[model samples]
Target: MENNTWSDDQPIVSIQNVHKSFGALEVLKGVSLDVMKGEVICIIGPSGSGKSTLIRCINALNDIQAGSIKVEGLEVHDSKLDQLELRKRVGMVFQQYNLFPHKTALENVMMAPIKVLKQPKDEVEKRARALIEKVRLQGKEDAYPGELSGGQQQRVAIARSLAMNPDVMLFDEVTAALDPETVKEVLVTIKDLAEEGMTCILVTHEMGFAREIADHIYFTDRGVIVEHGPPDTFFDNASDPRTREFLSQIL
Candidate 1:
């Protein structure tokens, strides 16, 4: 299930005129965007604005009722799409640190590669340890989730996502749950990943971080993208009044 069809010119993730709903409530309406390889796209908006839903759609965690989402040239909602294969290509980190309580940090990172991908234990362990270190948790590998702070647990979660070696990473307000003092560490780790050219799309409230790291920023509101542009222009001279109003409150 390698992605041989994707190319440098093609977007890694493409959402075209996408529409989504939860039972009777429509959450996303005709949204469209494209993320190129190694580009960091930051999505910002008020709560209930479909920021999270849009990213979830990209990974097929939430099915779209209309429009299309393509990742590496494969339709995300296609009937024949391989769920496991799609997950391997598009890694995601959620707001909550969903690490296994019983497993140590290293084991949590190693679990998926061994259980799902069927990689050998020795190889998985080696990579998991490196990933733990990559998230700056080298010494805490043996600690259980309960033994770690929120930031540490979140870093472990990020490392766990990296274990799969995804081509694109979707972050859904990953720092929203962390304490103020601890948020910087988790953000620094993500910043490092983006700088290293891992294609990243994030739904975040950290305006400062988004401004500093994102190649482009999209302001989504009420299920639609009000405006989007390069970080400097978006922050300095927002064209849409809706975007400007949103920025006024948050920034």
Candidate 2:
């Protein structure tokens, strides 16, 4: 299908004929999608459909066998540029809150800016504290990851990604590990980020959140984008049979 029609002005991320393989298993096949600046786009599909792989490739976590991924007009797969710098520009939040077990929330959030970016201690602390407050974890800054609840830990992870001030944020099933009660808090934090116009690409199964917050939704099946459109169009009147069936079961 024509996936490019949904393009708005200039795309912040572009994947063209992308393919990824792990050993003998091929996970992604000729997948192409565009994400506009400041848009919140969610990729939804059945397990092992390459939704996570696609997002990983965007930030160079997974190397694709073929095809090109461009982020902020820079080709990510190109060896000419520094991968570390590329990752700094494209921050990622994982399914499990990957905070250091020994580090407190504040330290977890401050680590990257201080170590990788080499920001001064005072500047790092200032920015990290502000971000902790932004995610509604003002007092929990000193709490170690072991002491925080699942949702609270995930919020810390989000704050950690924001510490880098990335242009694009990639969320790979961020709320999948949370209890239902805790999911809303994390989703609320994400919603606030969306409202603030952070360019985000999320891999999620939360249909309700996708409908309410996503600027666009991409439905993938068997390593291909079966259909893609605005949330109103895709969720309400999905064109492809695979998409329709998937939505029916979830809705």
Candidate 3:
């Protein structure tokens, strides 16, 4: 798969023997993974399993203590220029929907494209409006963050990320904080992205969604990936006992 160009070209992102620690706690230990273009890979595990941290490291949100991370052939360690450019290509959606409280939905989506990408103001507004409509928040473009429901706020967050036109999207438990009724709306937005061939790496506990959407499943325990395979193999026939134990509790 690694050699074939059309289907198995160089991975969009690669992490090799990655390690990270905070004081006495070592969060990631020799973790490695590859994310190919247009493939959706889901990471599932218990809290404190380092799933979020692993995703954060890929976009350099969390610095790694050891190992190498490459995004689109550029190494992502100890280089400010490369890291800055790498982040522009990788968009992240967080659990909390970190939209600026002061900005309206439309402005929030336009900020990065205008400031960082140097897009013309008129063009940025046009794209932002289209993205807001795409996420089904058309009439709420002028709504403040406080005015929208959790689902609407999250949809705005997703639109803001998409406004950048990223090559890879990382979703870090994006539905974790939403109400049960609101969760489906966000998940539906994600489902649409998957159907559109977006390359996504998701860290989530929604096993049903993972089963339906993930091309590959990764089981992480204590900061290490114990098993990884196609969803059928990983969910039904995982070789590791730990993977089975985890699935039994959730599935």
Candidate 4:
């Protein structure tokens, strides 16, 4: 199952003993993980368990107070590191669809590449249109954000991220805010991306989806990783009592 596009020896995203705090509330406590190229790693845990905070650290969305994170060998927290370069390599889709309300779906997908990357409009538009179809939203290209359903807007958000040509995609509870009926559509889009050999890190409450898609599953608790393993072992034979307890409640 090796992907020829990326190597397996060196990790693409690395985190070591990371600690993050928001004022007096300490979030991530000595969290550490490594994401290999073309791997889908799912982070599952109770709310406020630092799952979201940890992924945010990988792309420098949240600053770490201690330890280090590196993406493609560049230090994420380095003061001299180029933020735009980091973002271009790592794309993130949030729980909320943050599309510009005034822009059409195609315009939203095309905005960043055209404005930030200075790509030619025609080229960006072409890719944007293709991405729109990739996410199964071909006919809605001209629809405004306000006109689309939550799931459609989220699929558009995924396409917008894809327009940047990111090497790694981070999904932070992307389906959490959608209606029950619409959640499956967003999950299917993500599953398709993972199958296409995208390196993905997901913070999710969807245990079934995690078990189905993840090469490895990480369970976090109390701001630290309680247990991590392949879905088969993690779900049926978790070593940590906390992991078992959490799974019992959820699964």
Residues 1-251, model 2: lDDT tens digits: 12234233778899999999999988999999988889999999999999999999999988999999988667889887677768787989999989999999999999999999898999999999999999999999899999999999999999999999998999999999999999999999999999999999999999999999999999888899889999999988888988999889999
Top-TM-score structure, candidate number? 1
The residue pairs found clashing in candidate 4 are none
> Best by lDDT, which number?
1
CA-only RMSD, every prediction: 1.2, 4.3, 3.2, 3.5
Q: What C-alpha lDDT, on a 0 to 100 scale, does residue 19 get in candidate 4? A: 93
* True-vs-predicted CA distance for residue 21, candidate 1, Å: 0.8
| Clashing residue pairs for model 3 | none
TM-score of model 2 relative to the true fold? 0.95
- Tens digit of lDDT per residue, candidate 1, span 82-198? 899799999999899888999999999999999999999999999999898899998999999999999999999999999999999999999999999999999999999999999
Tell me the lDDT of model 2 at 52: 92
Model with the higher TM-score, candidate 3 or 4: 4
Off by over 4 Å in 1: 1-4
The residue-by-residue lDDT of candidate 4 on 82-187, one tens digit each, is 8998999999999998889999999999999999999999999999999999999999999999999999999999999999999999999999999999999999
Provide TM-scores for the models: 0.98, 0.95, 0.95, 0.96
Q: Write the per-residue lDDT of candidate 3 for residues 124-236, one digit (tens) a residue.
A: 99999999998989999989999999999999999999998988999999999999999999999999999999999999989999989999999999999999999988888
State the C-alpha lDDT per candidate. 0.94, 0.91, 0.91, 0.93
CA deviation > 4 Å runs, candidate 3: 1-8
